[model samples]
Target: MEHRIRHLSTYSYDPAALRVALRLKLFPVDHEGQQVESWKVTVNDEEVSPLVFSDLGDREALWSSEDALDQLTITAEGIVSTRETNGIVRGMPGFAPPGIYIRETELTEPDEAIRALMGEATGDDTLSRLHALMGLIHERVKYLTGSTSARTTAADALKDGKGVCQDHAQLFIAAARTAEVPARYVTGYLQMEEETEELLETHAWAEAHVDGIGWVGFDPSHNLCPTERYVRLCSGLDAFGASPIRGNVLGETKESLEVSVAIGQSQQ
Candidate 1:
């Protein structure tokens, strides 16, 4: 499958600020399942700053504003071709050992409920057990757009029984960890077949390391593995760790953000 992706992020900050700096991990990962045909990033209508690939294999763009600007805008546009790999991430450079992903993060900390769910879904085979866990989470958590916030943790989402994709990914990560599976959070874009608008948004999923099979993507929100429709961006212990953008304001000022993304199948 081929896709056209466009992402726009606008930040409005009080001019009282001295400088603003940000690190962007918005570039899609280059792996066996996906190929980048053309990609570009820009800020305030200008080409992006120098890009550096992180040790983890994610492309990083260092963007900074030195002037007292009222707003900053960043845009990323690209065309990518992807193939279904049964959710297995292969041909990608490995950064850390699988055991590293087993470490718990604050957002993915499992509670009694998560442990119970993991136990009930556990099976002899790791792959089957993971699939069961994903289904269990999908069934338990209702997808409500505004039911949770960015700061909401997996435990909180599980308790409330309502959340968005981030919550589902986090909850799945937590449960997988409790079951002794090494899982990480993934952020990316999903080309929805029903979407007809020019403005879309990013998506989140989870990846677990299966012995002998490597890392496999699982999307509890859809109760399935990522396929050709999925385009991976980055991965970390949780949402915050894998955020597409991370930045700091140099002065005391208020800031507001707006993001728009559009993804659709393209004629090759």
Candidate 2:
């Protein structure tokens, strides 16, 4: 699968905002399942270059303003070729053993309900248990756009039974980790088939480490594993940590953001 994707965001900060800065994880690395054909990130109108970590292969960049600014615009565009790996993630030039993912963040901390969910999952092994857990979460949560915020925790989403993909992923991760399975959050793009797939924005999902299979991607919101239509991005212990863009401002002010993502599939 070939995908040409562009993510554009404009931040309209109030005049009270004096300065701003951002950390970008916009670059994608070539891995066993995907190949980066072309990619770039721009702030306002200037292109910024990010460096890949020598030890981890994670790409990162920092953008800041030297003068006072009231508004900012950022754009990340790229083309990637992907292959269906049957949800099996491999050959990625990075390392953070599964133990690191098992460490829970505030957003993924499981409550009594989530822990009970762990007990409800019946499977022959770790992989099958995760699959059962995925199905359980998808059945429990209702996918509602704008129903939850960035700060919503897995417990909150599960109790409410409503949220976006972010909530689904976090809930799944929380439950998995509760069962002693290592899981993490993944943020990326999904190329939807208009007639068959739900059109979603800035996709988020979960990946769990299986004993014999390594890391496997799962989309509990969609009740399926990630396929060729998915483009893997950065991941972390939780949603907040895995965000593509993290920002900071110097003054007290209200911030309004407008975001747009355009994904075009090619018949190649």
Alpha-carbon local distance difference test for all models: 0.88, 0.87
RMSD of each: 1.5, 1.8
lDDT per residue (tens digit) for residues 123-149 in model 1: 779999999999999999999988999
> Residue 33 of candidate 2: its Cα lDDT?
92
Report the C-alpha lDDT of model 2 over 147-203, residue by residue, as the tens digit.
999999999999999999999999999999988889989988888867333434689
For candidate 2, report its TM-score: 0.95
Q: After best superposition, candidate 2 residue 199: deviation in angstroms?
A: 7.4
Candidate 1 — which residues are off by over 4 angstroms? Answer: 196-198
With candidate 2 superimposed using the best TM-score fit, by how many Å does residue 26's alpha carbon deviate from the native?
1.0
Best by lDDT: 1
